[model samples]
Target: MLEEIAIEDLGVIRSARVPLSAGLTVITGETGAGKTMVLTGLGLLMGGKADPGGIRPGAERAVVEGRIDLTRHPEVVGRVDDAGGSVDDDGSVVVVRTVAAGRSRAHLGGRGVPQGVLAEVADELVTVHGQSDQLRLRTPAKQREALDRFAGSEHAEVLSAYRAAWTERAGLRAEIDDLTSRAAERAREAELLRLGLAEVERIDPQPGEDAELTALTSRLGNAEELRQAAQRAHDAVVGLDMETEGSAVHALEQARRSLEAVAEADPALGEQAGRLAEATYLVNDVATELSGYVADLQADPAALETAHQRLAELGTLTRSYGDTVDEVLRWASDAGLRLLDLDDGDDRVTAMRDRVVELDDRLAELATRVTAGRRAASDRLAEAVTAELSGLAMSGARLEVEVRGTEPGPSGADQVAFLLEPHPGAPARPLGKGASGGELSRVMLAVEVALATAGDEPVLPTFVFDEVDAGVGGRAAVEVGRRLAQLARRTQVVVVTHLAQVAAFADAHLVVTKATGGDDVTVTGVQQVAEDDRVRELARMLSGQEDSATARQHALELLESSAVGR
Candidate 1:
């Protein structure tokens, strides 16, 4: 609910503050007293379009501010926080808007915010109904929402479930399209993988095989030279099968034998003899290993050819998949995993097709239930609103809520609309098309009255009407006032009206009085009036003479009767 609103330097309102209450608050004044400026302030607070012409002459900027109680509206406060703003200490939000000649700015909860942020949050905070809203009532979507709201929780629940199922079905269909659209691409990719795998399998390359084969080929290509070198080294280490050659082992043995003969004469010669014997043993072992190496060396061309052929095969694999045999092996391993994933395409298509079918069935079931609930509620809403129209002095008017089945939407498969027949024997036509301006206004009022029954609905916290009472007077205007008061019981209501009967029903009445200062600047002031002041205001409203005894008495009677009637 809106607690207070302060507007400055906008239109003819140089400065004005309106303190609102729970029930209806009516703003009334003389013709040029700037009564509509209060609603203009509301428009700015709700993030409406700004105009430079609205700036008061010689004023630097025009500003509008509002304090709204969020005790019953935590979600709106949450939105404020989401926009990086904070609420007031009293837990109410402060929304302020300022307009300059060439620019405008908006603030929420004491922090600067984008106008769109205000637009988004204000949608949940207030619903403004005016002459234009009566025109908007003719739209089918609005009609559908109105009927659904009248259907209460049952319709909302069904609609919610239906939307969920519909969304699921849409997602499944998109997935199915994606999978089906890529059939040829998947086939091409799979075939390419198969050919690469076939080439890798034929070669049967191992990790490091390229390096191992290169070493083997190098050794085999020089086998002859390696054998000759091995034979020379063997001959040097041990005595070869040739004359005039003495091996190291033989020399060492002779030295040990000479030292042993001397050891009989000296102990020093005995230690020298032991060292020579150990050297002779080591030399003999080396000679035996060299002899075996020389005999085993073979310069064979066939083995060399096999090694070169294997190296070439590994080269093919390296060029195709990697720079080396080891990297090629890694590529093969990764490709194996990818091949498994690619092979599952057909299976995934089947699964998604099944899911789409399941969602379609569920969507149909939910849509059916939603349509049923909407139809049931449509009857009740039409009956109630039609009765309200009669009470609003459209005695012969009838409201028909038509709920027809259509393709499924987020809400449901039901397309709802309202038609009006102003009297008997007249063909029923859609709301704005059939009704006159006065009838349309009354119809909107009646719909609001009917909607008041939906207290449990999650709707806007406040409703503002800009001259919704236009073209309405007498008993009809009083009925409009009572209905607005009735509507306000569930939420805050502010109406701009010139009807004294409507003003009489307001829990709070504000009068906008404009005066020309010494500088010839027109300044408007808003004052909340009660008791005698309100009566005098009503007297002026009724007969344009506050001091007339007859008007005063009549105004007094209106206040008393309006209070009793409420």
Candidate 2:
């Protein structure tokens, strides 16, 4: 709901604050009093195209600021928050639009934002109907949305199911396309993997095998040198050659005997003799192991050749797959898993194809149900709106809602068009094709009133009608006012009208007056009137004179009649 609009330097409205309220608020004024400026200000707040030509002469800029209540619109609040804006403590937001030179700037909740952000937030909060404005249901998509909303929650559930299935089917089709397009590439990849796996399996490389082979090859290459060294050491330790005087074991025995002979003369000598005896035993053990080493030392050429052959084979496997046997084994393991997936490509595609078929069938069923629901809603909506048109002085006019089959999409497989028949014997035509401005306004009002009572909550919080009472008078004007009031019962409504009958039905009435200053400057101002003041304004709207007793009486009667109707 809009609480207030403060406009500055816009057209003839130099500076004016228009206070609005719930229910229907009507603005009435003379021909050149600048009543349209109120809606122009509103249009700026709604992110409509800014017109520099509309700016007041000698003024630097034009500004339009609005205070909107967001208590019932959490989605709009979220959008403002996302745009780095905040809501007021009273659950309201301030939107300001400033037009200067040739550019315009928009501010929301005290934060500067792009003009498009204002439009996005306003789309959810307000709906405007005017002479040249496009109807909300003008587009086929919007018509479909309105029909679906009228179709109720059960149909919405069916739509949700259809969308889910459609999304899944699209995904499966993409996967199938990818698999089909890449079939040859995958086949070649699989062949390469198979060849690599065969090579690895043939070699049967094990962890640490490369290091083991390296050690064996080193031992086999230097066997003769190792044997000679061991034989010379054995001769030195055990006196195996007589030319070696006093081997290590013989020398230790001589020392032990000398120490024992002296032990009887000195006790310290006995301890030394015990140490020599331990040394002689250690030397004898070493000499025995050395003799065994010399006996085992021999070079085998055949064994050496076999170790080289195995090492060469393992080296070949490492150079291609990895730097070592363990790394090669890891690579082979990963390749084996990849090969399995590549081998199953055909089977996987077939499975996904079958799933897509199932989804197609499911979507077709849901689309049919959705189309049926829309057709049913179209009939009821047409009947309700046509009845409203009769009350608005189009007794012979009828509304036709045609639901035609089209290609299936996320919405459905239907195209909904709202056609109008002006009177009897006239062909039904699309809205705006043949209808005059006044007829279109009345039709739009009827449609809105019908939609308000169509068992779905109103989509917007406020509805504004400019010149809705055009070309209407007498009981027909009264009916238009009543219908607007009816719509206001469910949402806030603001109308700019000239008809006294329409003005009488407003919950709040504002009169725009133009004043000429001593400097010869004409300025417009808005003032809310009530009681006798409102009656005088309505009288002025009824006739050209507010002081005429007859006009005042008629205005009073119109007010009374509207009250009773409400």
Candidate 3:
């Protein structure tokens, strides 16, 4: 429910902060009072288009803000929590909107939000039924929805089941259509997959094969140079040299004998002679190994040519598939699987068809149950709506819910319409064509009452009625007030009217008044009247002046009667 509304620099409302209660909050004042401005402010806060012309003559901007308590609104609470916004200790949500020259902004829980978000949240919080509510009834879609609402929870359950079934059937039908439409494309894809798999298999590339080939190729290309280098190393380590007196071993042995001759002159020279003898022996063993390596080293041209051919094959695979042997091998593995699937297409399609049939059977069963449930609900709804219409002074009118089968839809397979008869012995027709403006209001009231009592959840938290009492007065106006008050007990309702009887029914009254200063004129102020003041205001509404004795007495009596009922 709305907790408060604050308006500033908006048309005739300069600065006004009006606190609201949870029931039927009424706004009334003189014919030209800024009452309409209050409703406009609400519309703006709900993301309605902002008019730069709505700003006061001397003001640069206009602002409208409202605070709502979500204590009973679990849906809104969950949304706020999901969005990371705060819900106050009392579970109240704050919504604010500001408009300047040509720009506008909205805020929720003090955090900035897009105007669309404000509109979404506002839609969950309120519903206004201004004088134009009668015309809205003329729409066929709305008429259908109203009928559904009156049908209660049974219809909702049926609708839910029907919609689920319809969705599954529709989705499968779409998939089949798509597949049927592209048979040629699928065949082309199958051919491509088969060709790719065969091509890759012909090469049969192995992991790491490319690296092995590269190493072999490098060795073969440098075979002559490698053989020459190996020969030189073998000779340097232990090969006998014809130019020298002897091999390294022989030279070391000659040096050892000389060192032994000098051993007696110094003890350190004796130890060095023994070390040289050991080195000469080790050199002879190494020379034998080097001779073996030199004998084995050779270059084979045929083997080098074979390695070159293998490298070229790998290069082709790299170009078409991957840069490395491992990547090419992986591609081969995946291609094999795709090839198998394409060859077995008929078997795969058969399996999908079997699964689809099973789903279809289950969906059909649910749809049958849904249709039965809707028929039952339609009967109950018609009864409730008819009961409410009697209280709205349409005692002779007949309210009916006409539910019939229709093509599958997101809602259900059932189409519901509301029919009405305005007078006794009159032929019943659709509500849109059978009811007049005043009669539409009465019918709307009946539908609202029936929907509220029948449904498990309320669709809207607030209802706005603009000139609902356009042609009603006396007892009829009082009845309208009574019905509004009853609705207020369940949800907030706001009405804009010039009738004093209607205004007198409000739990809280706000007056809009225009003021002129010097040569400038603007609707810049609003006042909330208290109990005694409200009586005076009502009297003024009744007789156009508070000083009228007859108006004051009647206003006092009205207040008393309203109090007694509460």
Candidate 4:
């Protein structure tokens, strides 16, 4: 329910603060007095589009604020609580919107919120019915939805069943389409797998063979250089002395003997001579080992060639894997597993085909069930809507619902249509062709009433009807007023109407009047009327004369009679 509306610098409403209450409240004014601006303010608070033109001339911005009560609306409360906001014990939710020439912003519970989020939350709180509501009856989808609500739980159950079935069918069909479209591609992939596997098999690569071959190649490639260096080193350490006619070991032996003869004369020289003799014996042993090394030093060319050929074979692996033999060997092991799977392609295809067949059968069965459920739901919906038309003063009118099977969609395969007949013996046609504006409004009202009954959210504690009485008066106007009051018992209702009959039913009456100060055109004030004032106001509405006693008496009787209706 809207608790209050505050408007600033918006058209004729320069600054208006209006307090609202529960039950039927009326706002009455002369033409151009800016009653529509009140509704416009509410629309802005509901996140409707804005225009800078709505801002008063010379004003930089316009601001509108709506304070609403949300006692029974826990969904909204939960959202606010999640965002670390608290609703007062009185359960009031404040929504404010401001429009500047440059931009607009929305505030919820004193926190800034995106306009789109504001709009979504507003939809949960209010449903505004205006002159355009009558035109909505012309749409087939709206009519079908109205009938479904009237049909109650049985129809809803059928719809649920139908939707479930339709979903399964749609999923199966989509999968089949995707798989069939890719069949040729899969076939090509299978052939490529076979060729790649065959090529890898022909290589017959051995793991770790590259490491052994690398070591052999190193030794063989430098064999000549290694042997020559070894021979030269041996000749330096133990080769024969050419001038002495004997090896180095024999010359050292003769020098040690001459020093031994002088050592007996000098004790220190004798010890040195003994050390030289031991060194000479050790040198002879080393020379004998050198001779054996020379005999084994020759290089083999055939062995070098063999090592080069093995290195070339290992090079083939480097191109496929990393630039090394270890990596290629690992790749071959992985490729073998892939080849095994490709070899079993026929078995895989058979399994996939069987699964597809099972899914297709399930989809067909579901489609049939969906079609049947939709038809039943359609019949029940038509019956309920036709019953409601009688109470809306369209006794002769008939409503028909046509439900037909369609291709599967996200919603289901049920396509619904609504048709109507305005008078007895008239053939039923689509709503747009059959009902006049007046009839359409009543039909829409009836539909709204029914749908509101079935709605899950608490009915807004207040309703504001803007000129819904257009093209209607007399008995029809009184009926509209009576219905508005009836809705008021469950929720507060505010209406702006030109008809006196409608005004007579308001629990509180407010008259909006304009005043002019200098060149300023302003909607100056709203006055709450008392009983005596209400009688005079109703009299003036009835005959434009508060002075007429007869008109006043008639107004009293109208009020009394309306009380009885209540």
Sort by TM-score, best first: 3, 2, 1, 4
Tens-digit per-residue lDDT, 412-444, candidate 2: 789999999999999999987798878888998
| lDDT-based ranking | 2, 1, 3, 4
Clash count, one per candidate:
0, 0, 11, 0
Off by over 4 Å in 4: 21-23, 71-92, 111-114, 132-139, 164-399, 424-429, 432-439, 452-464, 489-492, 507-510, 527-530, 546-548
What overall lDDT goes with each candidate model? 0.83, 0.90, 0.74, 0.69
Could you tell me the lDDT of residue 262 within candidate 2?
A: 85
Provide the lDDT at 205 for model 2.
88
Q: What stretches of model 3 exceed 4 Å from their correct place?
A: 58-61, 67-123, 133-146, 219-308, 333-369, 393-395, 425-438, 500-505, 545-560, 563-566
| Pairs of colliding residues, candidate 2 | none
* Evaluation by lDDT, superior candidate among 2 and 4: 2
Q: Which scores greater on TM-score, model 1 or model 4?
A: 1
Candidate 3, which ten residues in sequence have the lowest lDDT sum? Answer: 129-138
| Candidate 3 lDDT over residue span 1-566, tens digit each | 88888999887778888777877878777766687788888888777778889887788888888888888788888877765667899889887888887788888887787888777776677766554333344565565666666556776666676667667767766766656676677779778767766766777777798898888778778867876776776566555562256456657877888989889999898999999988876776676665675576567688878878877887887888788979888877887786676666656556656767886776667666666766776678778777776666677787777778886566656676778877778888887674566677767776776677665666467777776676777877777777777777778787777777777778878776677756576555667887778878888888888878899999988888876655
After TM-score superposition, what is the CA distance of residue 470 in candidate 3 from its true location, in Å? Answer: 2.6
Strongest candidate by TM-score: 3
- The TM-score of predicted model 4 comes to 0.60
Give per-model TM-scores. 0.72, 0.74, 0.75, 0.60
